[model samples]
Target chain A: MSEIRRRDPRREWIARNRLHRDHVSVLAVLGQGNTPSEWLGPNGVMRRNPHAVGFIGPNGLKRIDRSGGQQGGPATVATGTAASDSRQAVTIEAPAFLVAVVPDMSGGRLSSHDRDLLGLARQLADADPARPGAVLAVLFGSHKEEALGEAGVDRLLHLGDDAYEGYAPEARLAVLAAVERDLAPRHWLLPDSPLGGADLGRRLAARLGERPATGVWQLEADAEARGKNGSGWRCTARGAANTRDFLRPLPRVALALAECAEPVSETRHAAEPVTLAQPLPVLLSRIADLGPVAVDPAGVALAEAGFILSAGNGVTDWEGFHHAAKLLGATQGASRVAVDDGHMPRHRQVGATGTWVTARVYVAVGISGAIQHLQGIQSCDKVVAINRDPGCDMIKRADLAVIGDAALVLQALVTLVEQEREEKRHAA
Target chain B: MRPDPQKSPSLAITVLVSVGCHPLTGRGRRADQDARGVELARALPLAEVRLLHAGVLDAGSDAALRGYLGMGFDALTLIEQPESSDVVPALAEVLADHPPTLVIAGTRAERGEASGLLPYLLAERLGWPLVAAVAEVEGVEGGVATLLQALPRGQRRRLQVRLPAILTVDSAAPAPRQSAFGPARRGQLAVHEVGEAVPDAELVEWVEQPARKRPKRLKIVKAASARDRFKAAAAKAEGGSGQVLDGVTPEQGAEAILKLLKEEGVLRR
Candidate 1:
């Protein structure tokens, strides 16, 4: 009953050759889909043939992926989804110039903002393929990201010293200044984020006496350009607190916003380790960092909160809701109805008119999901709705919707969390 | 508005304010972060808070400058400068003339280029330390001020910046007090004619435009294989693919929420 089907090398060669009379039948028997991309015609005129199977790209373009991602139809599609090793390895040896990028590296990962900045750097570096530049990433402290090469970094300058951690903008500024003096990079790109780059970028700009373009979100290769190095480029930056956009020529230094450019998706770089040619200058910093302060989640600002426990009109048991928020270490937020009913302060309201929160996880208990409320939380990664009404808008929007009494659910969650903590404590 | 020298402490705080434009109506108002900086300075005990601005006091910005005055200030020192001129030198000169123990400013302006570099340049020129994204001033001891710096995701860092240092307020700082119409109408803009203005050549050359709406990043199934795409599509559609559990008991609901919380790495335990 058991049979080992072995490979037929001669038949495979004939099917692949495409010149044999029995090629068609051999391919059919081998279950290998036909239609070669190109073959010599009968008269020796070459012909280009389109594949019968092709996938539509993200932009709705019919793209035939020759990386062996798609073939043999859906039946054999599950065989391999090797999208990992498809990146084209690119190395720019003796780059004409350098485009330096300083990523935030928050939580020791290349954040979306950092990736976008790298993408922008890639644009500048890859502008002229004949005289291509290299992207030099300036990393501070330590990082856990393993895909620095895939993130479009050509050169890596890591400062793993303990003195560069915490709020050491002064020391970080000194490193950037040294980089500027030694490498003389063509362009300096940094995320216009408050975490660290925004502070350090401004200091570097001041020290270099380069009027950097801050709050930059969009960039265009200009027709008529003028600059010392970053010429032929223009940028659009948000100004007046995002009320207007300032279109200006791209300068030597640029502090860009998140999503300024699409991250490098198709290529991998060397990410070769580099070093400062000179030693870092010791600074007599007047600001002394005392490390991080432990802040209660409840005291966290709504816009800055990573996880939010938000309540709504249906939240009857206010005491249980507050208890759950405190126990879960989640920031407290309220819907407009809850705020208007005086159950919560207006500042805590979550809606279009209220703070447009970018929390990673938004837990909406008893929220009906008003249009404005949904709009305000549009940027949140996950929405958890706990409501009795399954047909509510919040339930539809939630990644996980729990239909039940808000009070009872809160009580059960609190009890479950307490039990988990108690078990962990006992195990320790 | 000077307090009696014998009664008041010698702590001087100056908040640099800028005119803000409403995103929808384009109306002028007090810049959000500057107002927060002013609020932070005012919340500090026994500190003399002064509002400073360096831009043309036109009708549009006059109302905006007065908005800061409405926050219980008698006057705002407005150093007259042209539209395309660099204001850092003027603001730096004022700070150097009467160096304050602490200078507060917004992360960035709401008008013009709004590079958010004024404070750094001022600090560099004055040779003083500069702290960015400060949430609150805990207290001042001797000549150093202990400040709470706001980090991403609601975390904070404690720092001690020496006297005559500049601080830039983060958006996470405590909200500003509402401006009063009565004070806004009565408050005078103490306009000062400064020295010759140096036109910002780069700013004058570039064009200005309305903010363009960025395209939303679509969650495209970037699968390399047809099988992978088919599997991804079958697993979940764009929207309306969420799981809704009905007729579940409170304990069951709690279990589902806990599972999701754990999956998202939000549950600490």
Candidate 2:
């Protein structure tokens, strides 16, 4: 039988490799040498650099011994280091800056950073010109082409494995640690949307004992502003505080009240031409030197009506999911429950680690108001929460809280809305 | 009903609320938002209920969590996966040594890595039948335990699982019980350390944490008259005044509206 000739997905990879001929050094941790098209653009450009390298434990990898070599054969065994060129890990010098096209899940689709993420990336790129920039992105099985087209990226990394998707907290963190140790970029850039990326950044920052910031609309630095230690960089950014409420406020207090809301505007999506004078640094683990990932060349997934009837943990059962759906003419969404049950995709998650959405209305049912979850939906114009516990964190954050079971509250609300619609029909 | 000896033998049920987002680089979850898996975990009738806050822990938050841990469980276990967003390893650690007959968590974390992948992952890893979105877990009987599962459209289903199985309790399970101040204050938290070290990343600048927003109030309290009865009557009558102009030209209707507004002192002539 003739062996089937498999087409090399790396043909475009080789063409894309032509651009990186000038790059003298490249570092990849956990390099799998997988098909390049999955991680790169159709033309072979890399996208979604989601892996980094850090010091992993000694036993992190499987040990290999020489099979049946003679006395003088290659050393019987070799110790692998996190930075070793082994398939499991590798090490290299830190790049000038780390550029990640941080995944934004707002509107249930992949999006680029508003002015904030770009500003930070540009500022960091300008900070040091010698080292490469590392671009990291999260791909939700779709958006492969769009991710590769994101502006200001060098190498693209992909961190999607069937098992990794099912990762628990420890396995998830391990991958991050590995990514950190491999690509030691000076400056790390991420989008402000919820998804584990920015939180990982914060945790990574805390682990490294560095200060972190949020809601940074823009970033700037004086060329002369040096780090206190004279070895790092200094930068500043514009931050915002938005408030969300279900009720339209008295004009006087509305502005003050507005401080708690999440930003309602989603990231703009366009296939506009972006000029790249020079390649930005993109370092990722597993794949070597995949370059210049793009922003959502593909549009994101969003609801047309600009409304979300979101359920939180407060929703004790599917009954709540049903009730909330009826009251607002909303599509049923779970706070990971729907996704975990295989009803929805992880891309639809709304929280710090999932997608960030600011619809006109976000009705949170059975959800406790946590700061992280608030970060995702606070931009919505109005928010309502229902729970038996009036003091659940969500109650204080909600525009209105009906103190009852989510099911009961949703049923009552559905009836009220239905009656209103019926009366309007009759009057008409 | 008599309890089945094999079903309840040395079996301990524990609920683990998965908090924190799935780790993707670039964005963070909201500060005030979460899936409230903690409440779901508390609702389960188990030997212990643990809320795992895997998101970025701001400064001075340990005491707050410790306070909550003191409420009532045998121990409040803190699973720390420093600087990493992957939760599978932590779940692996827990199930490896202390495999509970039943394990429950939110579908996803509140902040990073909000993939809602833990329950499936745990079930697959443990090779257990995962009853997701479970509403109620009846006691062990005849070597099997019955669980009320929440189906779509507010429906429910019952399933019986053998002992030593994993079940993911969803928000559709039942109303999570309220945490009383007393139990919350007295519960003892036994902090368990996972063996992963956080890496050192560069620090740029500290952005001042923004304040969370509160709900808003109404702009106008429209009352036509001072008396409550009069106000109610006026409100009822306000919607009845518009006259239908079925055959009248739009121009004529506009002119009539303009004249009425002028007479009422609403518009200038």
TM-score of each: 0.73, 0.33
**Which lDDT tens digits does candidate 1 get at residues B75-188?**
889899988888888888888888889999998877777778898999889988999889999999899899999888878889998888999999889999999999889988
Q: What is the lDDT of residue B75 in candidate 2?
A: 51
Candidate DockQ values, in order, are: 0.45, 0.01
- In model 2 chain A, where is the ten-residue run with the lowest total lDDT? A248-257
CA-based DockQ, model 2: 0.01
Best by TM-score: 1
True contacts kept of each: 0.83, 0.00
Chain B TM-scores, listed for every candidate in order, come to 0.83, 0.55
* lDDT by residue (tens digit), candidate 2, B1-269: 22354664444555564322223432332221122334444444433444444423543445445444433444556666555445556666767787766665654344332333455556556655544455566565554676665432233455666656655555454444344566555665455677674342321123233333423533244332245344565552122222323343333433433333233221111
Each candidate's lDDT (Cα)?
Answer: 0.86, 0.43
Instruction: Kindly provide the TM-score of model 1 when superposed on the true structure, using C-alpha atoms.
Output: 0.73
Q: Model 2, A210: alpha-carbon shift in Å?
A: 8.8
> Candidate 2 on A368-417: residue-level lDDT in tens?
76666777775654555555675566666665445666665455555555
